[model samples]
Target chain A: MAADISIGKAPHPLAVLPFYGTGAGFFAALAVLLFMTAGELTGHHFNPHVLAIVHTAALGWGTMVIFGAAYQLLPVICERDLYSVALAVVSYVLLTIGTILLVWSFWVFEVGALMITGGSLVVVAALLYTVNTCATAALHQNSSVQRAFIVSSALWLLITVIIGLLLAINLRVTFIPRNHLDMLKLHAHAGLVGWFLQLITGVSTKLVPMFLLGKSKREWLLYAALVLQNVGLVLFLADGYFNPITAKMLIYAGIVALGTAAWLVYLADAYRNRLRRKVELLMKHTAVSFACLAVGFVLLPMAYYFTDTRWVSLYGTFLFLGWITAIILGKTFKTLPFIVWSSHYRHLTGKVKVPLPKQLYSERLTVYQFYLYLAAFVLLVAGMIADYMPLIRVALVLWMMLAAVYAANVAKIIFHKPMITDGNRTQ
Target chain B: MEIELNSPFAAELVKAQTALMQVIDPELYVNIVDLGLVYGVDFTNEAKVKVTMTLSTPGCPMGDAITGGVKNALETVFPGREIEVNIVWEPRWNYHMITDEGKAQMGLE
Candidate 1:
């Protein structure tokens, strides 16, 4: 079957703007915080300050973008409008307020009323988003694997946030049965694998084909990935809590590795079948992210073996910076231009000459951003493993530069204006 | 410089085409005519302007939105003239159908 290119009625672009804006803000903040606190970060991954920084990057930057992108892409993916625009607005407001307060409370190492309040607000936001997306998915009668992945990922997101809230309260009331660090690991994995990775895989399955003008016949591969990833994540969490056995950990790692391998194969097949001969700049970055994911999966088992904090940090750096952040940076450039273009120039089309979506931003700047991001990602992993604070600081600087360039590009697209003329002008 | 309307049908057709330029393909961010969506326009005896067009895809969810856009554009241009916008699927649109001006705007040239 041909890929679904249904031009559905998306929610107002403004509904998703706050998320993109806040996500960018958090990314910048995380980069700056990392640069300033590099010295204090050595061998302190579990410190409250470090947790604050991680969450700033994870929730503020990563999850924020996912929420906004989901709202924009769901209608196109599912062939149905969003269930409720009002709920989307409410979710955005609550998430913004919640993220700010939670990040603040974490910075001060306060697990008191402030933390509780922030956590509660975030929980509510997650619930609202879950309900909206789930309801939208239910409207589509066909059982698409992509839809299943998306809905299940949303459920995982809810679970991740609920666990987070409990962890926050546990810090104060001491009600949790498991150790704090163990619970933290469970919470992190649930968000990373169950939520972010699953959603990315699902969305990419549809997008890779559409962007490449290719056909994907391997539906079974996608289903296998979904099953392996969720199952592996659950078992991994279980191993963290109850088993703590090396054999069980290895089994979980192997399952996740198989899922990653399947995903890589799917992408490779899509690329091979692509009709578009020239790989665009966005796809270039996407390829780099896939390489990062491959390397991270290889190191996963090793990271489990070595009980060193450095190895663990290296694993996380690869997972977050290499795979997640890289893909986001790449896909943002591809999607954002079209969105801003439609918003600004939809009414002016054919009446007068208008720039194409590609003309809205500088391609040269995007290339530079990709290189800087890749270099920073490598340096970060090396610095973490070696406990070299200076290298990490330099990496942080590079990351900030990447973020700034991206922000500037997006702003250019958002604020673009066309010159009016009687006739259309050729580029 | 103002030009004389040689014929009411000809003048109305020009005005209608100009109005249709205001209706855009929301996803492509280009007007339907430029996007090769408007196949043809016919003026009936009753002064009704009928537009035959197709979407980028058959399953396009913005079908209603673009159809509404066509009606509004025609009404604004010729207030008293009746308007009929018909969506057809024959002779599917391709990138080759884009006009030189549209191609230039899209950087396809």
Candidate 2:
């Protein structure tokens, strides 16, 4: 600590903004793709258009925003600085290029060198990310389970991309003995369960309580969640490798489900004890996210039982767009404004007046975006179930508007000029 | 912040504490004075006003802003004096440190 006030460990805004800006751009593009490919949703999800859409959402929208947020979040969780901003930037570039190439290849049904190269670059990027995250965790020897899950998630990301790369290569060579479909299932679950699930659980454990001014005395529940989720995933991958989607897959899924239940229980405890009794819209979005998760959970077995591909598609929609996107929409406002506020107004503080983080963005736009996302998601799911093209197109139209609203708000924050402050503005 | 009756700087300290009411913690939305983050205000150094205080969390992302608010608030009130904010962690801040006004603002009552 400095005798004179130095500062906390916030990374430079530029290091974080590139990913956020690109991710928002990708999401806007994704909305356009959704509108264009509205017909593809009810068919088998392995089609070219579906593959393109999934990659666009997964890599472009989900992973990119996360990479940017992780720079701010990992430091807070680890109580240390990010190991390398340059590595973070490198990974973002690699991910951007790889996603564009890979998604284009999928769209055109080209499964040759370009796709393989794209997948390879993505794998290398994931590896570098894992190295950076692990190095940061190593800086402090804290044994918090949050750290464990965070680091483990990076490892899972590496595994996911490696599997993805191998799958890409196998399209031509067929080197792996296992069935390609089976390997795809393994890769999907690894990324979904291993990477996103664990990462959200870990990060939310810390953030939820802090934001709510809540406390969870149940460390044991977190430990249980950690053990069950990881063990179940390991067994699942092994089963998918050897037996290739056997009946026992249900048992493994059930075990993982139990692990997820543990984390939910912990979050419930925190919510019950929260000092901030009046919940904000952001927290409400979080609740809706879990509700979306429940819908995905219910769809899981139906996706298994019915050979109809729509169930699986619906499951993906609920999990990715419903659960993940909902939370991101809320959390973006939560963290980004604070980050921008700190960067722009830190020096001006204690000398002149300044605005609060919340004042930097439009709350009205966020409310509209939130409602629009929910309506569009529900209508899309309903449209797919009934095979109604008109309804589906309407939903897609709303989604496109929602994406624009979201992007506009993000830009509003990024470009927020320091308006006049009172001689004594504080909060 | 409490003013001791015996202290010679009690009147100046009172004014200083009153001015700090304008500085609120963004997260908590309560004034630091009411939140009990301000430990003491020392006017002994004729040239500078010394503030001893603590944050609700050590790694507060808004640490700079809150401390800077204190500096600005004082500079506005006492333009000639240099403001020195010395953050301490000796007595960690907890819910108990909060005054009734703070608790009311936090909806903890």
Best by DockQ: 2
lDDT of 2 by residue, B6-100 (tens): 89998899889988987877767788999999999989999999999888765566777788889988988788999998988668777789899
Q: For candidate 2, what is the interface RMSD?
A: 3.4
Label model 2 with its docking quality class: acceptable
Off by over 4 Å in 2: A1-7, A420-427, B42-50, B71-85, B107-109
TM-score of chain B of 2: 0.96
Worst 10 residues of 1 chain A by lDDT: A1-10
- Model 1 ranges with Cα > 4 A deviation: A1-7, A40-42, A417-427, B1-109
Across A297-411, the per-residue lDDT of candidate 2 in tens digits comes to 7898899999988899999999888888888888888888877887877666545556778899999998898889889988998998988899999999999999999999999
Report model 1's chain A TM-score: 0.93
TM-score of chain B of 1: 0.85
Q: TM-score for all predictions?
A: 0.84, 0.93
Clashing pairs in 1: none
Question: Model 1 TM-score?
Answer: 0.84
| Candidate 2 displacement at residue B81 in angstroms | 6.4
For A201-301, candidate 1 gives per-residue lDDT tens digits of 88898787767645667878988998899889888887788854455677787897798788778888987876556787788888888888788877777
